[model samples]
Structure formats: structure tokens, C-alpha cells
Target: MAGYTVIDFETTGLSPRYGDRIVEIGVVKVSHEGEVYDAWSTLVNPQRDVGASRIHGITAKDVLTAPTFDDVAPALLDAVAGRIVAAHNASFDMRFLAAELERVGYVVGERTPPSVCTMRWSGAFLPGSSRRLRDCCASAGIEIVGEHSALADAFATAQLLASYLDRCGGRPMWGDEISAARAFRWPAPRPAAHTLTYKVRADRQPERADGWLDRIVARMPRSADSRVDSYLAVLEMAMLDGYLSLHEQDQLVEAAQSSVLSRPQVLALHAEYLHAMAAVALEDGILTADERSELDRAAACLGLAQHDVDDALAGAAGDDGADGLVISGISLTVGDRVTFTGEMRMERSVWEARARAVGLQPAGLARSTKLLVAADPDSLSGKASKARSYGVPIVDEAAFAKLMDRLEASAD
Candidate 1:
């Protein structure tokens, strides 16, 4: 095998699905002889907040004048075009890069280069020892500096790769077996028929719904990693559509509980989905006594408390407020768009529904949005800087909740 590119990216947040973007990238090219042949690093404007700046020490000000991802994408593509892209957590970097590249009209075709995850390999090979790059490097006597900086992390990863190669036997000649093991094959795009889609009914009735279950099942990726998510999506869609007969919904929940994989994590997520759906069903007055007992049993299987179930049920019931909000003593109806930020212990769905119930539109303070609900209205990130620049109104969640309380009390 001909060498590989050790890559790392400092992203705005953990998940790419939640609109997070990458702010910086680093790569160190290692030759077949296990020597660093070239190095590259760039700070790209993520166009958003650097949430974990305290840990990485790279801030919005540091990247203020930096080039956008588009500006440096071509060069980045050229550098790693034919090389294996290796990283500590390769999927994290790869998924974000792939999404961004796809957004900019870049075709990462079926022949796209392969990516190797050092973390996965290390865990398999170096069993019973810490696999973190810093710890691995220290144990292997490799020098690394500037821990969180992109280039520094890349360099550290490269050193670890080199050490692994040395321990295996310095500069072993590559053979067909090794070559095949290191071969790069692009992932085939899953067929459209297997893709999952989220569908909502015009009437928003959960019990009389047709096609909702099928639509949710279709939306789930046929991959093993997403099967649990697919089941959960089905349950949520059933609730949202309000078309499932109480018996049919109960059977569907039973199917999910019975058919889930043996993996505890997958089962746990399914349990949560079942619990949430049950709560929604109960609040909607669609569940029978027996079905409610079954759901309670499911929650017990997952080690969830009755109080937790009650809280979730309350949130679902209050989702579309029964009363209008009082804005300076003025009553405003529900379904209005609003936005929220800052510290919130409530589930995001619950928070979002509360915002909508107050006759306010929940939205992020980007140029595209018209409103902002700052949970911590005075916090620098919530309402100041870019959010303030967009001229969106910021209100604390507490204030919004207070208005909602007053409205409900008046109605009562």
C-alpha cells in the first residue's frame, strides 16, 4: 500500500445532521517509508459559533478573516484525491467533509478514496490500554505538541501510525493481501427505495392515519446502524399522524419491542421511543387501560421511572397549548414560530413545542429566520453578536413560560 493522509477536523459541534459545520482542517501525508512527506492546515469560516472553543482554544475572532470552506475545498480535494484518508475517528471527519463537499456540488463518486479509522484499529490491536492519541503517543514514546490544534493532532496521529508500523516490523514490503486490505472503495449510494421519508398528515390525526407507518419505515436507511432509529421514527410518525387505532399502535409498539436487535444500546433507544409514543398516545386519550399497562411495562424494562414517564406525558399534552399566551397582558394563540438557545435541560422537542404554543415562531437567529428565543437572553452566544446582528427579538424561556402559565391560569 502507498502511504496515507492522516486527517483531523475541528468542527462547530458533534453532529453534522444538526447544521454543525467544520471550522478547521489538518492533514499530514505519510510516505510508504513511514515518514511525514507533507503537512497542511487551514481555518475555514464555519459561519457559526464555536461551541467548544474553551477546549480547542480556536474562536470566531481567530477565524474572522479566514477563507470559507469553498475557498479551500478545491485544494483539499486535490491533496487527498488518490490517498487513503486516515483519522482518529475517521467517520466523524469523513461524514462532515462529505456533507460539506456534497453541498458545494462536489461529487464524491463511487470511486471516492477510502478512509481508515485509527481509533478502531487501535482498540482491536492494543486491547486493555487507553487508545486516545495523547496516551498512545506517550506510551509509544512519540512527541506531540499543540494538542487540540488541527495540525498538531494530525501530527500526533501520524506519529502513532508510524509507531504501529514499527512495532509490526519496520517497513514490511506490501503484498497483494496487504494491498487488498488497504484498498479504497467508495460506498455505493443506497437505492432510493430504501431511503426513509418523514410524512405528516394534513389533518394531523394520529388514529385515522394511513401511510404514515409505511412512509416512516421507507425513510429509514436499510443499514444496520440505523435500524433502531428507523423503528423509533416509525413510532414517532405514528403519534404525529394521529391515525393509528389504539390497538394498531399498541401492536406496532409490541413489534418494535420484540424485533429490536440484541444490542443494549439499540434496545435502550427503542425503549425510549416506545415510552415517548405511549406518553403521546395516553395524552391524546387514544390508549386503553391494557395498552397503558403494557407501555408501563416497556418503560420498566428500560429502567425508566414513573415520574419520568409522567413528565414526558405532561410535556406531550401541553405541546399544543390549551390556552393562549399573554404578551404584556395580550393573549396570543399557539403555533407561532420562535427560537431558543442557551442552557436547557428540557428535551429539544418539548422546548420547541412550548415555543410554538405561545404564538411565537421558534427559529435560529440566522439571516433566514425572523425570530429568536434566547433561553439565556443576556448570554453572549444566545442574543449578542451574530444573533443580535440579525435583529431578531430574544426572550428568556422562563419569561415565555411565565406568559404561558398566566395564559393557562386565566383560561382555567
Candidate 2:
């Protein structure tokens, strides 16, 4: 054989049988001598909520613009073609690979190519070492920097595989498997006119010559009355993290351009958004220090100066005598139902308890749900998705905490 194709997948959860899907995949090609030929990775949109993002660091927002498994199937097939597949836990990786390929209409028959499981053979190489990839890497004196990330784990596994090859006196350790791999035939997939690939925001070098908001505004043509709802929704999601990634910038630009929003109109929307946050902050008749800090961060993310925040706060405070302002479509009442999604730093039960203490009803996601609290405001969890479709405002934990404070004040 020539070399092995090492692969890894960061998935929504264990078992495609449970509707879990691959959110990201990493492939590393190494020569028989353990020389790395190429390493590639991409975020794969699962088309459903990304489950257990805490493990993989893949939020729903990260894959918002990513290519689906169907779109990237062609490229992935090409990568593993004619090569022995290797993974830390070969069965898990192989299972997901086969399942995903099958889902894309590839006739991945009952038989798959011979594969190497670095973890499976760890007992022989690093006697007494655990099967965990991190543990095996530690025993081999190899460091995995970004654990759980597909590419980082794949590269580390490649290094471990190289060590095994070196220890085995430069001969093929699995002669039978290699032979089987050589005889194995890969199923032909439908040829795609163009295949797509997308990296997570963290993987791509940011285009930071100017602020993301400015870049988005630049793409827009002047229009008298540009549609605001679509652009506003995109803006709210992008600001969830208080920092816009390159992909998010693209989303914003696309939203604005498609809506025919002009530079002035977009700027106005930004001002309105900040003002809305400010108004919400002061809804309880007081702007807590934390709320002010939150507004400041929002202002920075929107590419607005501190003066703009001051103006927004002043404007919002001036409106205190009028009907209370709602921020991003969120208006919380004492009995309004709220739902939460994604893994949060605080326990879900604790959040629910706090909600009850504040006279808010914590309930399952439904059309009647008034608010959605998410670890990532742009979470793609089923609850978050349903909440968005219902026009419920999603807020991060910090924002939720601030809201609780306001609720208590209002109740008093």
C-alpha cells in the first residue's frame, strides 16, 4: 500500500441511528513512510439542530453558511478514495462516514474498506494506555492542542499512527488489512458539477481591514426604503457573540443586499437595535451596571461609538414615560413562558429555578414560548430554531441574567 487516509468527525452526537449527524470532518493523508501529504477539513451543515455543541465547539451559527453533507460528499469521497482509512476509534468514524455517504445516495454496501483503529491497537504499542485519543496521545508523548476539534484530533491521530509504523520496523503492521484494502472497491458516487467546502469561522483568517458592519454596508446599494426585518434578524444573530466572523459578515452583506438596504438605512437599523437594547435595559426603571456594560458591548459590535450608546441610552430613557420598549422582539412578562437550549455554564435546572423565582414560566419550546435563552444566542438547537420561527428573541446567558434582574425590579 502507499499511505493511509486518517479521518475524524465531530458530530452532533453518537449514532446516526438517533438522527445525529456530522457537523465537521477532518482528513489527513499520510504516505507509507508517515509523511503527511495533505490535511483538509470543513464544517458540514447537519440541516438539523447541532446536538451537544459543548463537546465539539461547533455552534449552530458556525455551520449557518456551511456546505451540507450532500454538497461536500463528492470532495470527501475523493479524499478517501483508494486509501486505507484510519481513525482513533475506527468503528465510530467509519460508521458515521458510511452513514453520511449512504445518505447522499452513495451505495455504500455492507462491506467497507480495511481500516486502522489507532485506539484499538494502543494496548500493544503503549501497554496499559487507555483507548481514549487524548490518553493515547499522552502516552506517545504527542500533544493534541484542540481536542474534540476534527482537524486537530485527526492530525494528532496521524502522528500516533506514524509512531506505530516507526515502532514496527518499517514494515506493514496489518498486512491482512492492507491486502483487504487493496482488494476492496469503493462505490461510485454521482458526479457533482461543483462540490463545496466551508471552514469554521475560527479556521479561516479573518478579513479585518475594516469592521464587519462597514463591509456589509459597503455591499449595499442606496435604496429609499430598504426592507429591515430580514436584515435586522441577521444582524441580531451576528451580534449574539458580540463579534462578527467572516462568514457572519458574508451573511450580513447578503441579507442587506438582498433586502436592498442602503448604507444610511442599515446604519439607522444599527442605531435602532442599540437603542432597543438600551430601552430594554432600562425597562425596570433602572439601568444596572451590567446592563450598561452589555449595551456598551452591543454598541462596539454594531461598530457604533460610545457617543452613539449615550444617544441610545438617552433616547431610550426619554421613552420611559411611553410604552416599555421591546428588544429584538423580546418582551418578558411575569407569566410569559421561556425556554432554553444548548449547553450553558449554569445548570439548566438552576436556570429554570431562577425563572420560577422571578415569576417567569420555564416551559418547553412552543409557539406560545415568549423567550428563548441559549448558550449561543445563534444556537441551531431544535428549541432555538422553533423559537426563531415563532419570532421569539434569543438571548445569551448574560442577557438572561440581566433580564432576571429587571424582572425582579419590576415585580417590586
Best-fitting candidate, measured by TM-score? 2
TM-score of each: 0.45, 0.49
226-281 per-residue lDDT for model 1 (tens digits): 22333443344334333344543453444354334344544445444443444445
**What count of clashes does model 2 give?**
0
Candidate 1 achieves a global lDDT of: 0.54
lDDT of 2 by residue, 1-412 (tens): 5679999998876556556689999999988888876998898999999865645777889998999998888878777778888987676677678888888888878864468878656645775454467777988999987877888889999999999888877785566568777887777656876746567547532222334333222222211111344455346435534566655566566567654666665666677667766665666788777667766877776778889999988987876421221133334778899998889899999999989988889988888887788886544477865675575667678767766877888878
Report how far residue 179 has shifted in candidate 1, in Å: 5.7
Report model 1's TM-score to 2 decimal places. 0.45
| C-alpha local distance difference test of each model | 0.54, 0.70
CA error at residue 129 for candidate 2, angstroms = 0.9
All models, RMSD in angstroms: 24.7, 17.3
**lDDT, candidate 2, at 274:** 70
